[model samples]
Target: MRPYWCVAVAAGVLLVSACGAAGSGAAGSGGPVKLAFVYATSSQNPFQEMAFGAKAAAADIGGVDLALSAPTGINGPQEVTQFLSTIHNSKDGVALETLTPDLFVRPLNQAADLNVPVVAVDTAPPAGTKVGLFIGNSNTELGKALGEEFVKQVPADATGEVVLGNDIPGLGLLQQRLDGMRSVIKAKRPGLTISGPFDSGSEPTSNFNNWNDIVKAHANAIAYLGVGAQDAVSLALIQKNTGRKFLAGSCDPDTSALQAVKDGYVFALASPEHWLKGYVALRLLAERAKSGKALPTGWWNTGSLVVNSANIDQIIARQHDEGSRKAAFKAETDRQLANPSGYLRPLAEAN
Candidate 1:
C-alpha cells in the first residue's frame, strides 16, 4: 500500500471520535475489557473482512469492548499513532495490522512493558517488536501455491514472458510473494522468462493503468501475475477489455476478483483468508485479557485458501456475512484450539 501523511489531528479524531466499539457487557467485574483492532485502511474489502472477524470474536467472547480504528486510506504513521493511543488508553490488549513492522517496534515493545498483550495481524512483527503472537498466512507458501496454479495452467514449453507485479513494491510480504513465484517459475518452466516485480501502484486506478501498460508493452506474455487483490481485478478487467488470452492470477480476493475467477476471466486466487487473521488475533488477545495469561508467542498460521473454479461457489458463499464466515471457519478454529502446535509455526517460518 502507498504511504500518505495523515494529519495528527485527523488521527486523533479517528481514535477518539470514529472508532467503533462493540461489546457484550463486563468481564471479571472490570466493566468490559477494552481491546483495539488497528489497521492501515478501512476503505477496502480485506480490512472490512478483518473488522467483521474481530467484531465476531468480541461478540463470541462477550464482555469485550472492541474498538476498530483505521485511517480511510493507507497511512503508516496514523496506524502507529492510533496504536500508541490504544496502549496509552489503558486498553487491555491490541490487534495490529502493519506491513511496515519497523514503524511499530517502539510502541509494541512499550505495550509489552505495560503488560498489555499485542497480536500482530495480517503481517508479522519484526524482531524485537515484542508482539505475543502473529496471525496471518504463510505468505511465501501462499505465493508458491499461486505460482503452482499458474504453472499448471501454462505449458511447460511456453516461451514467452510471465510478467509479475508487486502492488507495494518494497513491502517484505509482497517481496516474499514475488520471490516465491519467481523461484517456482524459474525452476519448473525453464523455457519461460519472468519479467518483473514492477511497482504496480497500490490504488485501483494506478494498479489497473500499470497492468494495462505492461500488458500492451509485452503483447505476447504467457501470463500476467500479481501479488495483490487490486492486481487481480485489474488484470481480469484488462484481459476482458483487451481480449488478451494471457493467464492471470493473484494473491488475496475481493468480490470482483472472485467473480473474475468464477467467470473464467481469471484463473484462480490465493486468499490469505484475511478474516481469519483478525479473528485469531482478537481471540488470542481476548483470552489473554480474560484469563490474565500470557499469549502464545509465535506465528499463528491462519492458513491460506486457493480459490479456483472447483470451489469458487463455496468461497463466494462463505463471504456473505459474519455468521457465514464463522460457520465456514469453525472447523479450523476448533483445530487451532485443539491442536495449537499444528497451526503455530516459528516466526521465522511465517514468510
Candidate 2:
C-alpha cells in the first residue's frame, strides 16, 4: 500500500510485453478491443491475483487487448485521475475498481459519452451511473459472513470485543464490510462490542502502527476483522510480535495472507472468486460488443468463497499448477455464466 516502485516497474514490464505480443492473437473484427483495468493496491497479493486473472481471461478470449494499471496506494483522487486517463486513451472498453464512488462518476460518464462501455470489478461505483456491469462479491455479505463466523467462535454467554480495521474508509466496498459485520454482530450477539473501525491508511507500516495501538488498548479483544491486506498483515505481525494469537480473519485472498492462514496465523479469509469475476467481465464485454448491445445499467453482484484450512490445499494447488490465478478464474467464470439465474443477480436484489 505504500508508494512502492515495484508495481510501476512490473506494470511497465507487463505493458511492454503485452504490446509486443499483440500480433500473436487475432484482433476483434470491428477493431481491436482495448480494455483498461485499474485496481486498489498494485503490490498487494489480491490485486496482483486479480491482475493475473484479468490477463488470463484476456488470453483465453484471444481477441481483445487488455491493459492493466493501478496506483501505488489508496489515494482516491490519484486513482480517479488514472481512471480518467485510461478513459481518454482507451479505444474500446474500460473496467476499473472504484475506491470512491462519488469520485468515479465523472470519468465513468466521460467514458459513456465516448460510447465506450464501462464495467466495475472488485468494487462498485455510485448508483445510477452508466456502468454497464459489475463483477464482484457483495462486500456487505462478506462482512455479515465475517460477523457470523466470529459469533460462532466466541463464547455465547460472555461479552467479547471484536475490532474491525479499515485500511481506507473512503473505499465504499470496505464500508459495506464494516456495516454488514456491525448489523450481524449487533443482531446475533448483543453483548459483543465492535470497536474502532479505524482508518489504518493504505500502507502496511501504517496498518501495523494502527493495529499495535488497538492491541495495546484492548488486550482482551477476542478477534480482528481486516477489510484489506494491510489489516490482515497487521494482525499477523501483531501475533508474531506479542506471541499472542487472536482470531484473525480478512476479506480477500492474497498469497502472503493465505500463507499465513496455512501457517495457522489466520483463522479464515473470504473473497469473491476473483478469477471467475475477471473472466465473466471479459466475456460479458465481448458479448455486448459483439452483439452491438448496451449492457445493463445496475450493479452485478458476484458472490464470494470462504477459504479455511480445509480447502487451502485445493486453492494452493490450483494456484501452483493449473495456470496463474487467472486461469482458475476463467474456469469459475464459465461455470457461473452457464447458470446466470443461479449464480448471478442484480446488486439491488442480491442484498
RMSD of each: 5.6, 5.1
Give lDDT per model, in order: 0.80, 0.69
TM-scores vs. true structure, each candidate: 0.90, 0.85
**Model 1 — TM-score against the truth?**
0.90
Task: Report the C-alpha lDDT of model 2 over 47-144, residue by residue, as the tens digit.
Answer: 66667666655555444556677777666788877777777665567778756677877777888888777788877667667775677777889888
How many pairs of residues collide in model 1? 0
Record all residue pairs in model 2 with backbone atoms less than 3 Å apart, i.e. clashing: 53-326, 275-329, 276-329
Which is the leading candidate under TM-score? 1
TM-score, cand. 2: 0.85
> With candidate 2 superimposed using the best TM-score fit, by how many Å does residue 204's alpha carbon deviate from the native?
1.3
For model 1, residues 260-303, the per-residue Cα lDDT tens digits are 99989889999888988888788777777767656787888888
